[model samples]
Target: MKKRGIGIAVGTHPAGLKGGGDPSQAQIRLKPDGTFDLLNGAVDIGQGCKTILRQLAADELDVPLENITHQNIDTDTGPMCTGTFASRVTFMDGNAVLAAAADLKKKIRDWAAEYFECSPADVEVANNKVFVKGVPEKSLSMAEVGAMVNWGGKFLVGTGAYTPGPGQQFDPETGKMTAIASLAFGCCVAEVEVDTETGVVDVLKLVQVFEVGKAMNRLLCKGQNNGGAMMGIGFGLTENVCPYYPTMDFAVQDLTDYVITTAADMPPVMVEDIVEVPHPNGPRGAKGYSEMTASLAGPAILNAIHNAIGVWITDYPATPERILKALEAAHA
Candidate 1:
């Protein structure tokens, strides 16, 4: 007989380093052709950091998206980042890029003021053009300005760096300090069907809700949610490094022997929703959201399994053999 059950779990993840003082830096330079090069150390490990960062730069610089080229160069050429972990890229590195763009914008405005013989406050920059306020005719394209700046023996560059909070401070008595710059919270509900006779547990559906501060790119956020859901399912039911417990002997050696969840194992229905609650210190009000996307999936599925079979399978991967053994132990 197959029994069905549903369960929900909530999880939270922090952005930036635990003890604070995490820093990220960025640099931006304008090309003669009016395009921009944004250099940062935040690598895109398939999380679409390049796309979102470009979007941020374009928004800040008041230029078209294609006008920016985001480059993740080596330490020799790019700014320093405290590696990409703890879901810090979107929050920490993004702020660095925004700051760089702002710095670059100020330089452009100052140069335009000099060229137009106007005050920097009187120069207006928008849509890749610089003009004096209330005088649209007295304008020049960004490309033209870039060319003039280069010919004048000057290179336009902007550099910025960001560190969360006012450095790492500790309380003298309690030893507590501000850990994370920001936080992302999420909830996941999972439905599962368990067969008592054969000990097969099948996930039917997964629904997730996340508070991401802001969605930099909605499509990319959806993709992350889907990918995280799949990974969570794998953690709940299929992936195992040590098949033989209590000892490290005869462990699965490679990918060939390892059991994992594939596309065929995904639930039939999956839904992800985003709730935007802007952070005061985030870049464009966006938070670090990558890691929390997958945090609640395993626990939700485990709770569902207990509901279906009335047995708590405390072990990871929740293999059929383990489920069977748990059921036997419960009924005995």
Candidate 2:
């Protein structure tokens, strides 16, 4: 492949000035000592970016997932990144990592074939070993291959880079919007009971259904959706952002009143409720599931409340006072 043979496509927003630029970044270092370092500048933020990239590298190199060490998101050592936002890192950095790993794997296969006097196709690598496909007994570990390479001259190393795809910009004058090069969609349903008198809401159950194209780690995917649902509940019925002013006795009003969803408030989270819709740009057809749970919760909870109280609420954080008022109005 040429130097620029691997071109990755990505999606971005046109609203913010900085958001229209590059989508992802990555770096790879292969040492003669047989140890490798993959520095990914993207932050995980509990979205399993580390696990996902590790899988991509393992799959590309035909190496066991345990063999690769990921040194991720340290600003001092890793590449300068745009950080984790706008759901771009996995798609952008993942492709770059695949390219780098593929290059390294090719080099390894070529060197092994030359050392063993065999065709590259005759060698298979797995669990860090280069083996003759039919004669598994005749094999050399990755450490052996590293020792054979001339490290004093120049060790084997490779790097890959990626940016978001094109056709995402929108006209500033016209209210026209262009579809992102890639799109991911999801739905969630939450069941809650509101105490009419105290305005307390108990989340009885949460069912999140999302299409994540692919699931790299089923456990991590479920965790992300569950966490998003908890946060969504807070956004819908709790968590009010309050600002303070110096004129008001240098105190912030409602600081003590604002609430967030806690372990006690959370119900059973059913992950089977999530569906996997293949995303064209995702690694193995996987898309972002981090925010899907929350995106659908607001409307689901509002509709549920309307069904119970026979009133429609346009505003959020449907407090007890509001519920009581709605109930009174319904009776009157």
- lDDT against true structure, model 1: 0.88
- TM-scores for all candidates: the values are 0.96, 0.80
- Model 1: lowest-lDDT 10 consecutive positions: 162-171
What does candidate 1's lDDT look like per residue over 218-240, in tens digits? 99999999889888888888789
Best by lDDT: 1
lDDT of 1 at 79: 91
Which RMSD does model 2 reach against the true structure? 9.7
> Which stretches of candidate 2 lie above 4 Å from their native place?
1-20, 113-124, 131-138, 150-152, 171-178, 243-255, 268-272, 326-332
Q: How far does residue 303 in candidate 1 sit from its true spot (Å)? A: 0.5
